[model samples]
Target: MSFQRAQHLESINNNLLDIKGKIDVSFEFFPPNSEEMETTLWNSIERLTPLNPKFVSVTYGAGSGTRDRTHDVIKRIQKDTNLSTAAHLTCIDASKEELIQVAKDYWEHDVRHIVALRGDLPDNSAKPHMYASDLVTLLKSVADFDISVAAYPEVHPDARNAQADLINLKRKIDAGANRAITQFFFDVDSYLRFRDRCAAAGIEADIIPGILPVTNFNTLKRFAGLTNVHVPNWIHDSFQGLDNDPTTRNMVGASIAMDMVKVLSKEGVTDFHFYTLNRSELSYAICHMLGVRPTV
Candidate 1:
């Protein structure tokens, strides 16, 4: 490598070494739908548990099987390991009573933290809570559980504008959410701006930046489209012509994620939430790059 490239690598190494033990992280996962996927998910959990994530969350969707699977995974994690697990709860089609029972069941199962969400567009006949803020309120009523709600750094797709986006986030926070885990965004500046706006609006809850380690650029683009997260042209160029090279793609993914974490660390952001997408190696490597090595 050239002298300038060598210097850059040295700087990154120094940053990683300096931040040892200061970085706190959590991970997000969806419930496995198949026997094969379940094995993969457990393998991931076993690999990542040694890194000591603050919590691992299981996501719930509108489908009945998805909901059951999510609860089963959360309960299994709680029973099978020493890790703290959080359940994702959504107010999509369920009534308040049904949601209450679900929360109660989680409490009884020893899960106390919840990632409350409004879920996807509700079925036309479903009517109780309308938004995430309402879900937050319902969770608060059910129990004094540690609650987390989602925030959109680039603004939610359905939001009219940025101002309205912040307003919705504030509502969720005001409804007793302990902190907001942001939807993943590539631009660190967008996250910083959103943080500043939250402060300006007097919303003091923690806004943890969600980091997505992209294993596939195509999948990332599809998600970006649905979430209104702007995909900068540079990101496309970075992965150009590596479609057939999985190993190089993984390396690029790690490099991009490590760079993003380093920039956020310099900005004084300590906590991060990784959307693991049921794959552990990339996230495990990124956390290791951030100086969070296994203790067990």
Candidate 2:
């Protein structure tokens, strides 16, 4: 951090300190594959548990291959940790009865929260089936559970426009979603604007931006490209000379997230959800910079 950036951050830090309003945070984790991956996931969970987040979510994969693994992970987390766990439920390959059975299983296990979405088309398939009808229908069906749906700041890649996507989001919230977490996005402005547009559309559910800190620009770019998140030219310039420098790349990633959060906090948005990618160092570093310490 430069002297100028440090000074600005300190000012922001002071606001973050005496800001009275607690900055609620949550995280998203993927299901682990092997024993080694499971160990990493638990370690990451234990490391971040002391932060006392609002909730943590585990994502179900694209289809059947990983569904059982996702279920096992969610069950273990709920049983092992004190954190409120939200299981992501997608309508892609599963039929309506199968989806309900999963929800019933979650309810039986005391897992109440569900991240509902009409998931994207499965990989290499000629096209996606409209088997689930739509997210709103699914939301209505799952109204018995505390549900969270996906939001898109820049509009869904498949949506006609951002406004139209916001309408779709409003439909889900109306059907009984308690919160809406956005698809991972790089730009904070998109989230802020999306929030305003949600209010304009008279939807009042909590809209949380999914923050994805980039450790590898090459990988992040590809993920962003698929998700409709644009990598700014300035970001490219920031990482231009640091391709081979891991330490510098990490610093730049943290700085970028910090800058974006500073602007977001100014807009009265305190909640954050990091797509941790099962790594704790960068997420922990960014939280420390924001003055969110582990209070045990």
Candidate 3:
């Protein structure tokens, strides 16, 4: 190999070695809607449990059916695994009183961590009763729960501007959130700049980077569009002409995620959150590449 290529390989190796045992990761899973999906979710959890994630979070939906599933999954994980579990709570259709009761139930059942969010409105015309900061405040009133709130590196879709979005995040932190787990982004520089902005704004809470290992390019584009996350052209180029190939897609996805973590680690980012999309193979491979191994 050329000297330049050899040096690049050595640098990658050093980065991997540097981050071993220094990174803390968390995984996010959505509540499964069907029996088969539930089985798949459990299997993913079982496969990842050995890696010893800092915590696992279950996503809450806007409707009651999904709410119940989220709670059930959280409870089951708490009971079945030794890992810390966090429940996602949102202020969408529920009233303050109802949300308080839900918080109370979680606390009574020994679930102390919560990921609070301002869920999507049913329509543009509907106004939300409470935002994520409001939910954080309400959850804190019920108990001294460890709260996690969402952050957007690209900026929230509904925000008037990026500064407004940052202010909203600060409100959540001020209200009682312990940390902010960012929305998944492909651009590492966007996240680093956002982190700098947060520090300059006097927000001292840990802003953990959320890493989504892309399994399908089509699905990723759709999600990115909805969330107003920018999909860099390079990413588009990487997945070009690979739509029909699942195995190649998985390899590319893992390589992209691994490179992201290595760069983030060099910047002193020790914590990461993975949006598993209820599948573990890509996430598992990424974590393994980062030197996060199963204890047992």
lDDT of 3: 0.95
TM-score for each predicted model, relative to the true structure = 0.96, 0.90, 0.98
Question: What local distance difference test score does each model get?
Answer: 0.91, 0.81, 0.95
Give the CA lDDT, 0 to 100, for residue 82 in model 1. 93
- Candidate 3: Cα lDDT at 228: 93
- lDDT tens digits, residues 94-181, model 2? 7778887888888889898888877767664445554222544654575477778888898888877877787788878877788888
Report per-prediction Cα RMSD to one decimal. 1.6, 2.7, 1.0
lDDT of 2 at 120: 69
- Rank by lDDT, highest first: 3, 1, 2
Residue pairs with colliding backbones in model 2 are none
The sequence of per-residue lDDT tens digits that candidate 3 reaches over residues 1-296 is: 99999999999888899999999999999999899999999999999999999999999989999999999999999998898999999999999999999999999889999999999999998888789999998998999999999999999999999999999999999999999999999999999999999999999999999999997999999999999989999999999999999999999999999999999998999999999999999999888988999875
Of 1 and 2, the candidate ahead on lDDT is 1
Error of 3 at 23 (Å): 0.5
- Candidate 3: the clashing residue pairs are none
Point out where model 2 deviates above 4 Å.
Answer: 1-12, 18-21, 123-143
